[model samples]
Target: MDLTVIWAAIIALGLFMYIALDGFDLGIGIIFPFFPDDSERDLMMHSVAPVWDGNETWLVLGGAALYGAFPAVYSIVLSSLYLPISFMLVCLIFRGVSFEVRGKANRTKNLWNLSFILGSAGATFFQGVVLGAYLQGIPVKNGVFFGDAFFWVTPFSFFTGMGLLITYSLLGASFLVIKTEGDLQRRMHGLIWPLTLVLIGFILVVTLWTPMTDPHAASRWFDSPARFLLYPVPILVIVVATFMFNAMRHQHDSMAFLLTIILVFLGYIGLLFSIWPYAIPGAITLWDAAAPRSSQVFLLVGAVVIIPIIIAYTTAGYWIFRGKAEASTHY
Candidate 1:
């Protein structure tokens, strides 16, 4: 068996899980300003409070897996992107603290609310910057990151940062549609179509921009035989977007959220296809960056035992907390 491929799959699964689970909660913070009423904010926080912290487990799993399974890529990427990565971590710290303190504070609730918004937006923006920087290809030579710290601060990276903000806001809104009712649900439902339109616009920009600027990506999309397989992704995205629009129009709450998830998945697939086989895009293949075979075997054993347990508990948490959030509930 190719342990490198297996490990790569595991890391991909872990990252996608993180995006799917944690994206909405961080998104709640991004859209917090839209619903300025304190009570409505309470309900929004309550909807995600139970599972929000747990949603980050996949992030931990993904980072650890990368360190163990592909140490070279981990070290090089982290070192090169340290500034944005550090900023993202700091923002998450503020966001997590606000999540806990806002529920209890009587007078300082507004302060915490501000903290939450800044934290979420900062973390998400930097995440998109990091992603864009990675996609544009890290500067590497002889297995080391050779670029200066500000290499990630380009226009494309900032555009990606803004794009992620919209994406997560949409996720947050659709999730609220699932977890609230009455005026809050109505407002969220109202926001869905506009957010979807905005998201589609960002998607179109990225689709065109990536190929226009990156020769490798352009070749992958236009020249490779794999293009045949890749062609269905955008079509599926359109189909999913259409379904999501209809679901929102008809007020199919659960279906809207599910379709939104599908929309995100299709986008994720496109990204993976764009960077297939390359851990550092043009620089390094997964096999070239993979850790020793013995190390992977050991890590695989632990991952096998741990991943299922995490899945079981995460599933239980969601199931137990299912249904519309109550204003009286505090979490």
Candidate 2:
């Protein structure tokens, strides 16, 4: 296999880690507006506070890998996604700061809370928009970006943003059900069904729309060889979703959460499969956008040494902090 393909897989893995790790915390932020009670919010904040910063490490790794291994892809994406990415970064800044500032400000606790919620929701929405834009396609000409600055701003993109908000809320609620107890757990349980339904609706829409909108994607799944590869994906998704619902119904909170994560993972695998060989989704192939082989080799060297360390760090951190969070458990 080419170094380009190897690096692409690495970056994809990193992105998935970021989504599965930081995603629930971002989901927590998205659901912040629903719970008006200060004590409940505190518990929610405490649930994510210990690990939020570390969770973002995967994002940095993913971006860095993309930039180092495929400068052309990075440049094109940076140009096309400049505005939304900038806004997302600002939201992340506020969201991160709110975690630190919330505990310190007695008088302005509400303000910080608002910051956290808006930042989380805003960042999550824009991220979905970015994903939508990629699904639709990034306009490029001969390996160069040619789309307008606001090309990502579209009806489909906004629809995706809304869908992600619901999806994250579902994830956040499921996580709370696992990490909390009593009234909070019950409240999350009550919210899970509707959120699960909404997420399923979004998934259905994307599943249908993705194949219909892109001929390449359609053939990738429906054609013979790739078809065999992908045929089980939807079936697996259905099974996982069903299991999640059954677990939720039985108040198996941990099982429900695990199934939800599996469901998301299956969806991600399907997406990556549909867009295989393309880094920018129908625009740039992995080889075409790859940087020099020397650069890839250099980066691969560091990645080989550093990636394991990061994995160890993340695993140890989670292991150390594994327990149900309480309202008094402030970072």
Candidate 3:
């Protein structure tokens, strides 16, 4: 493969890792608002306490890979997404800080709790909004950005944000089904069934509207392949997800959680395949936006070295932390 292609694959892999790891936490954040009680919320947070930050490393790696491998696409995305991007980062920051401050500040526990929910909600919403904007094709002007900030945050985009949150939350709850025990685990699976149905509804609505909104996507679904023939992917996803969900219901924790991870990972791969070559969804082809080969090759060396380290540390950390969930005790 060419340098650009090779590096793009690497970045794609990093993105996959990010979605599989940090995605559950982000999904948890998205579902936080729906949590009814304080202890339940603490238990929810506890499910991710062992590895949330580590999961975020994939995000960092993806961002770094973008900067190093495709400077043009990176610039365009940043310029076009400045507002939503800032909002997302602020949400991450507040959510993270609240994790610490919530435990220590006796009087301000409620304040920090609210902050955590706000941060999580705000971040999750904008992330979905950003994806919607990208899928819808951002308005790229001259070399510099000129569009208004609200240009990307439409009703459709907002709905997409909600959809992503729900989807991820279901994934996270399914995760807790395996990672946790007792009443908490039982309760989490109860949420997953209804949540999965709701997520399916979201997918239905989005898929139905996608053709009218973005014709390019329709070509992929319609013109590219016979719908019946392409059923295997989703069929497998459903069957496997059903098996995992059922396994969790029966308290088969490891199989349930691992399958849940595979479900999310496979779904991510599908999305990536859907958006191949187009970094900005019809705005620019991956090849067109790729950086210099020389630059990519040089960076690949460092990436080749550091990526493994990141993976090793991340893997080792999770293996060490693997166990039943406990009440979140503030970081």
Candidate 4:
């Protein structure tokens, strides 16, 4: 058994769970300005309040798993992209604090609101930037990061940051459609189609841009026989988008959110496929970066015991909090 492979799968699953869960709440924060009515904003925040913090659990899991399972990747990637990662953490901190303080402030409510918006957007943008920088390839030499401090800043990284903003905004809107009612719900419904179209545009741009600019990615998609298996990814994306559009048109509340998640899943699969076998894309393969076999075995034992508990609690929290978020409910 390749413990390295198992650990890689665990980290991937953990990161996706974080994206799928926390992305919506961050999206809610991003789109907060669109629904300027205080009551509507309250509803939006409340919609995710119960699960927002819990949703971040997966992020912590992913980070810890990476440090344990692939310490080299952790050190090199962090060193290469320290600025963006640090900014992301700071933004998340501010965002988390705003979540609590915004509800209590009266005279300063607007200030907190701004904080929340900036925090969420800043965190999300930096995350996307990190992803773009990673995809572009982190320079590594002799198991150390060999890149400049600002290696993460580029036109492509900024484009990806904007792309993620749109992606999360759509997730936030679709989620609100399921959680709010009447005019607010209708407004969210209105936002969904436009956001969906914009998301598709971004996906198309990335699909074309990645292959054209990154020969490794281009060859992975075009020159390999794996192309046959990978062809359905975009087709599935189109099909999912169509269903999401119809779901919104018909006011199938939950279906829109569910299908949006499927869209995210497909995109996630595409990204993993694009960088297959590389922990630091074009730099280090997973096997080369993995921790010692004994260390992985020990961590795997703990992960096996702990992951199920996290999943169980996460499931319970959502199930317990399920249903429309009442406007009167402030969290």
Best by lDDT: 1
> Which residue pairs clash in candidate 3?
none
Candidate 4 worst ten-residue window by lDDT = 322-331
Candidate 4: where is the Cα deviation over 4 Å? none
Q: Which residue runs does candidate 2 get wrong by more than 4 Å?
A: none
Model 2, span 1-331: residue lDDT tens: 4898899889999999898888899999999988999999999999988899999999999999988999998898899999999999999999999999998899999999999999999999999999888888999998788989999998778888898888778788889988899988998988887787788788878888888888878888888485787778878877877877788778886886777778778778888988887888887888888999999999999999989999999999888888899888767
> Which structure is stronger by lDDT: 1 or 4?
1
**What is the C-alpha lDDT profile of model 4 across 174-258, one tens digit per residue?**
8888888899999889998889889889888988888877888999999987878889988998899889878887999889889
The better candidate by TM-score, 2 or 3, is: 2
State residue 321's C-alpha deviation in candidate 4, in Å.
Answer: 1.0
RMSD in Å for model 3: 2.5
Q: In what order do the candidates fall by TM-score, top score first?
A: 1, 4, 2, 3
The 0-to-1 C-alpha lDDT of every candidate, in the order given, reads 0.92, 0.88, 0.76, 0.91
Task: Order candidates by lDDT, high to low.
Answer: 1, 4, 2, 3
Candidate 4: deviation at residue 185, Å? 0.3
- Give the C-alpha miss distance for residue 6 in model 3, angstroms: 2.1
**What's the TM-score of every candidate structure?**
0.99, 0.97, 0.90, 0.98
lDDT of 3 by residue, 205-270 (tens): 775776678777777667775444444667777787688658756766566547766766555655
- The RMSD (Cα, Å) of candidate 1 is 0.8
